[model samples]
Target: MKGLFNLGPVFGYFFRKNDPNRTSNFNLRTMHFINKLSMAMFLVGFLVLLYRWFLR
Candidate 1:
């Protein structure tokens, strides 16, 4: 956990200052994609539950 905290600054620095022309890392892109998908799924699930409750 402490190591992650230490790397926070490093990641932040590169995230801000990295070159756009260079090919970025796949790992970060994949994580972001999954995060967005999970969020969308969660919202859809919540809406379904609400609709069921209203129908009840």
Candidate 2:
């Protein structure tokens, strides 16, 4: 239950080197790329929302 609040793994995902054992393919690569993009967009939106909330 405690792991849910931990952010180490989330940041680790962006910083860690690629696993050599994992198979590289087009679909997998595209999925990972999109996943990263969505996460980034969500974070940005959350920050903007906070900024607007504080200004009000």
lDDT of 1 by residue, 1-56 (tens): 76754755534543565568967689987876686678668768989999999987
> Which residue pairs clash within candidate 2?
none
Top candidate when judged by lDDT against the true structure: 2
Error at 38, model 2, angstroms: 0.3
For model 1, state the Cα shift of residue 28 in Å: 0.4
How many clashing pairs in candidate 1?
0
In model 1, the Cα lDDT at residue 28 comes to 81
TM-score of every prediction relative to native: 0.56, 0.83
6-39 in candidate 2: lDDT tens per residue? 9887778778888999999999989988988898
Which ten-residue region of model 2 has the weakest summed lDDT? 7-16
